[model samples]
Target: MRYHTVIAWAAAAGLLAGAAGRGYLAPLLPPDEGHGAWYASRAAGISAYLFLWLSLAGGLLMSSAWFDGLVNRARLLAAHQAFAIAGLALGLVHALVLIPDGWTDFGPADLFIPFASYYERADAALGTIALYLFAIVTFSFWFRGAIGPATWRWVHRASFVAYLAALWHGIRIGTDTGALPVAVLYLLTSSLLIGALTVRLVYVRPRRQAPARPPSRAAAEPAG
Candidate 1:
């Protein structure tokens, strides 16, 4: 759960950077009048930022799968689902905002498919895939009982895919891609997540052999 906390905090920071301050509060910065063509790129940046934040928060909540506490797990999963929906919603906002201009500018094809589209198509494509994956996994939880444990588990595994894509989406398009702060944050959070899982994999494994106690001559003599 400590790991989860890390994910949540990181995600919150990312979201606020792109959504809370970047998008809504475009305060005193000089306007980029020359880069008028980069509107789609800007929108993609906002979406990717928000998506990473939501995914981080969701990931923190998801680390509860290892918990033995039922109520706690449920609470965390609920939070995870909620943030994922927020990510999806923001992604749609990103897409919709582009619609009015994308068609006339780059033709309709670039908006849906990736790589072949406009400048920001990569991030947009990743966001779209992550959104669909989030929807499937989130919705499947409601039918958990009907699907039974195995199938439900498989469905939920899609969460990781969504998370990875969302993270990649953000890193690939963020204006701060090369910034020291962003790089430090990304490396620190990623290392923390991977490190914790590694510790569990190595140090937390079940004991396979009894500790070797020296064969004491005294104990052997006493037994005789």
Candidate 2:
């Protein structure tokens, strides 16, 4: 199957599954229950979105491999930004829907505040961090002429941190996963994607750019 097909299906299925799961739990979850349900809904929605955005990032990053056949690096970068921005819009929706829950204090500091969650506060912090990173990377989109490529590249590199943090945050809390196959999904798709991306960054991409190593001293010394 085409790469995009698998990505499309996974994202769609994750989204539908999360919505269905939350709806099924709604009647059981107290209408006045603490902010947890809001978080659950957001997590599910975001999970679906994460897959979608990552698929886009992956596709665009590797676009040279397929689709347009590596013709346009700048165009691929633009595609990535488009997908990421759409995902960010959905994420904002997730946050806005959850905001009225009256959970924690909402302030600029809380946006970066970490380890304060009595429930899943740390996890929330992680997600918030991811959101911020996304914002930074995409800032160049709006201010490309001003943001130079070097600074822009650094911001984009932080995306992996956001991805990992969000993934870790999602499955760790959220009561829905009690018997909801959360572990399986967490390990299989989320973790796998993270692992693959990390591996690609460390081992695959850098090997090409590494400067040529001079002949080993042992070799130059004539192997004794």
Candidate 3:
């Protein structure tokens, strides 16, 4: 528990630092136009997407039977969980950083509520929805015992919906989307996720039925 808490704090600090360093916060020194927050917002948004991709990939890899021998399942699971928590932290920073961005100022409602943003309303909505879905799936771990395995499993499945929403959010609102490298990155990650899901579904074995029992000796004798 301490370890996880430490990791969480570290990730949060790193994300905030990265975002702030990139220009998400107002500049300490006077600038020509004070676009510090704008630059930071863009950088943080892209960074959040990258972390999300890592989390998604890790989750898929953890679910993959193919890695059963190649890697330690427990370690992989830990890594997967770490990636998800980190991604969520970065994602939150990505959204919150925009709040101070004077150029594209967003409030709490604009960040959390769907269709509340005057600019890119649909795109912002997608991201907001995705963030909520991610929060539900990620935090469900803590309450899994209370919710029960079946319900928790179902909630975890919502990660897929979150993934799709995030993908669309990036494509629709990402500043670097038009770049060749960024486009390829999105395409590759999406393909990998699809392939992993396909393999997991197709390669899993069907359960075998128990063999039928023979008739009792007494019944056979009675027949005779």
The numbered model that scores best in TM-score is: 3
Candidate 1 — which pairs collide? none
Model 1: lDDT to the true structure: 0.58
**TM-scores for candidates 1 onward, in order:** 0.58, 0.56, 0.77
Error in Å for residue 206 of model 3: 11
Ranking by TM-score: 3, 1, 2
Residue-wise C-alpha lDDT for candidate 1, range 65-180, written one tens digit per residue: 44434446655554555555555555555555555653335444655565666667777577667767777876776699999989998887776687677668667866655767
Where does candidate 2 stray beyond 4 Å?
A: 1-40, 47-60, 63-79, 102-118, 178-181, 191-224
The lDDT values for all models are 0.58, 0.56, 0.75
Model 3, 1-224: lDDT tens digits are 34575376547646664765447333432363677665555556666666666666767766756687789776666656666776677788788877877777689998888999887999989998988898898778879999999999899889899989998998999776887766887898889888888877777644569898888988668553
Query: Residue 60, candidate 3: how far off, in angstroms?
Result: 2.3
Q: Find the candidate with the highest lDDT and give its number.
A: 3
Cα error of candidate 2 at position 93, Å: 2.7
